[model samples]
Target: MQSDICTIKVRDCSYIDIEANMAIVINNCFISTNVFRVSPSVASDEQPLLSYSHTHKKWLTGRYIGKLYFEYNGKPHCFEVQPRFGNANILILLEEIFNIKLAHNTSEYKLYDNSDNELLKKIISIIWVKTLSKINIHGLPKHKVEKLNKSSTVRGKIAIKRSVLPIYKEKYVVSKRIEKEVDSTIVAILKKAYIILCKDYSLTESMLSDAVKEVIRVPCYNKKVITTNQFQKIKYGAIYANYKEIVDFSWHIIQHKKQSSMHEMADTMGDALFLDMAEIWEKYLFTILKKCFAPRGWHVYSQQYRIYQNIGFERSIIPDIILEKDGHVVVLDAKYKRMTGHFSDYDRTDFFQLHTYGSYMESHNKKLIGLGLIYPLSERFDKEKLDKNFAKNLYGDSTSNTWFKVDGICLKDSHHQLTEQKDDFLRRVESLLLI
Candidate 1:
C-alpha cells in the first residue's frame, strides 16, 4: 500500500532524527550507515552523508535536494531534502540558470504536498527541453537497418527462395537493402518519458507541446516502457549523444514508479538528483552580474584559479567572482546567507577571506578598485518598505580610504518576474565596482 511508505522531508542544513540511517544517494549509487559517531577527523571514505554530532545528539543535513528511498529496520523510508527557499524558487532559479522554459505558477502545482515526485518530474521535463533544443536539422538519431528486398541486381545477401520463384523471376534478384532509418530505441524511450511526465505526473501539456510535436514527427514511434537491461544494451554515439541526459532522467522516472505500485516494493532504489544551493547561489549571482556588466566591456569570471608558490609547494586560491575592466579590478564573494546590515552579523572567516582576496589582487595589481561581500537580503526585509539604496551601501567606511563595502541583493520578487530585484542588484553592483 502507498500508506506503507514513510517520507521525511527536511530543508538543507537542517537537523534530522538521530535514529535515522544516513546516506548520500546520487544518481542511484549510495553510501549509507546506521550510526555516525562524532570524531575529530573524518576520512574521505568514511564520511557519511548526514554528519552526526554525538554531543548534540542530532544529524546535520548537507546542501542537497532530492529523494532517497531505502529500507531500514524492515520499513520503507523516503528522505526528501528541499531547498530552504522552497521548491518553487528552485524551479525558478533552474529556469533562469539553464535558459529553459518551465511551468509558470509553480505555486498552483502540487508542490506543497509531501511528495517529491512533482519536483522530480519538473526536473526531468527541464532536461527534456534542454536536450531537444540542441537538436539540429539532422533530427533524431538514425541507424543502418537491413531489409530483405527483391531487386534487379544484387546489393547484399541474395535471397535464394525469392530468386528461385517460378513466375517471372529470372530477371529479378532478391537481395538485402541496408537503409538508414530512425533509431526506434531512442524514440521509444523518449515517448515513454513524455507520457510519464505529462500524463502521469500532471505536467502542463502546453508547456511541452513543442517537444511533443518533435516526438510525434517520428513516424510510428511507439511509447513503451524500457527495462534496465534494454537501456544498458543500447549503444551511444555522436548521433544520439544529446539524448543521453534525457534518457537517464527517464530511467529515474521508471525506477520511482507510480503511486499505485508503491505496495510492490520493487528492488529499484529510485533516483536521487540534488543541486548544491551554495554553488547554485554563486552561479546565479555570477550570471546576473555578467548580464548587467558585460555589455560595457566588463569581464566577469567565476572560480578562476590564482596559483602561487608556497615555500615548498604550489598553492591556489579560487575566488568566486572577479570583475575587471581596463585594468581596474574588483574582487567580490557571493554569500548565499542572509544579511541584516549589522557588523556583528557578518562572519569573521568570510570577512577575512574576502579581505585576503582583495589584498592578493592589490598586491598583484596596482588598480584594485573595490573589495566587497554581496549577500542575499533576508526574506524579512520587505522590498516595498525599502528604497533602492538599501540594496547596497549596507555598511562601509569609504572615508577610511578602504573601498571595502558590504552589499545585499534582494532575492525575492513580489511579482515573481524578478525584474525589480535584478535591476536594483545591477545598479548596486555597478556603483560598488565603479567606485
Candidate 2:
C-alpha cells in the first residue's frame, strides 16, 4: 500500500490532520466552518486502559467504551457510540453526524490520513483557478481594460457605453449651454424689434406679422390682426380694458391650446359688462359733483363709507357716497331700482338698513346730519310727494322725535344729467341740517 493514497471530498473530511511531508493539495475548495460536529470521548478509566494497552488492544478498547456525541448542523445532539473504522461504522457515524440515514441511493466515502493533505491542495488549486478566471477588468484601471472609443458611434454599436466615458458628451453639454445663450439673445432682439414695430405701426396684425417675419418667418401672420372672436371680447369689454387688445393680438401670435367655453366666457363677460357700466356711472357721478358742489366747498367722496360694526354682529354696509363739508354728514344710498306703488320688502329693508345707521350714529351722540335713499324716477309716486311721504314715514306725524331724518330723492334724468339733481339734493340736505 503506497500509503493508501486516496482523495476525499472536502465535505467528507471536514476535520483531518496530516504529516508535513505528506502533501495535501486542495483545488477549487470552498473552505468554510462545518455546522455539524461529532465529539468522541472516553471514560477516565477507559482512556487509561486504551493508553496502557498495545495498538490492537487500544483500538479494541477504544471502540468498546468511547462515547460519540453527534451534533448536526443547526441542531444540538448527544449520543454514545461504539467507535469502529469499518464502512458500515463510517456510514452510521456520518448518518448520526448529518441526522440522515444512509440508503442504497446515497453515495458514501472514507478518507484516510495520507489523502487529506492532497485533497486540501486540490481544493485550494480549484479555488485559485476559479477566482483568477472570474477576475473582471472592464471596470478596473486603464491597464486592465481597453479605453472606450470617443468618436460618435451609431445606435446598437458598443462605443463608450457610459455618459461620462465620451468626450462628445462634454461637447454636447457645452453646445446646449451655447444654444441657450443664443436663444436668449434671439428672444431679446425679437422683443426689441416688436416694440419698435409696434411704436411705428400701432400693433396692427399685418404690421405685427411683418415685424415677426422680418426677425423670423412665421406662418399665419396674414390671416387676421385680431381674431373675430377676440375682437368681440375686446369690444364688449369681456377682458380688462388696458390689456384686452394686446392680449388678443398675442393670442393670434401664439394660439391657445384650449379656448374658453361659451359658458365660462359668458360668466366672465357679465362681470366685465357690469364693470364697464359701473365705470361709466362712476365718471358721470364724479363729473356731476365736481361741476355742481365743488363751488360750494362741499367735497364729495364717492363710494366712501364701508361701515363695519364691531360691537354686535359682524355687519358691513357701504353707502354709495358720503357728501361731507362744514360738519354735515349726508349719507346717500344709490338704488338702481325704481320705487314701486307699494314699497317692496327689499325697498323697506333698504330703508331699515339706512335707518339703523342713522339710529346708531344718533345713539352714539355723533352728528348724523341726515340719511337719503336716492332712486330712479318712478310712475307710482310724484318726486316731490314721495320726498314728503318718505320723510313722514321715517319720522311719524307730530308723534315721534327721531334724532336723524330719513328721506327719498328721485332723479328723473340719466346718470350723465345727474349733476343738476345732485346739486339740488345737496342743497336740500344742507337745508335739513340747517347748515
lDDT of 1 by residue, 32-61 (tens): 221111110111123234666565578776
Worst 10 residues of 1 by lDDT: 34-43
| lDDT per residue (tens digit) for residues 1-435 in model 2 | 123223222111012233222211111111111001111110011111111223223211111211112223323222122212222333332232223333323222122223212222222122222221222111111111233333344333353335443455453211111111112222332343344334321233332222234333422223333344543433312222322223332332222111211223222211000001122223333345445566788766654233454656565555555566765556655543334444331457877877776665456454556677654333324466545445533455534333233333333323333434555655655566445
* lDDT of model 2, residue 372: 71
lDDT of each: 0.59, 0.33
Clashes in model 1: which pairs?
none
Instruction: Kindly state the number of residue pairs that clash in model 1.
Output: 0
Per-residue error at 287 for model 1, in Å? 1.6
Task: Please state the error at residue 13 of candidate 2 in Å.
Answer: 99
Could you list the CA RMSD of all candidates, in the order they appear?
9.3, 46.1
Q: Lowest-lDDT window of 10 residues in candidate 2? A: 28-37
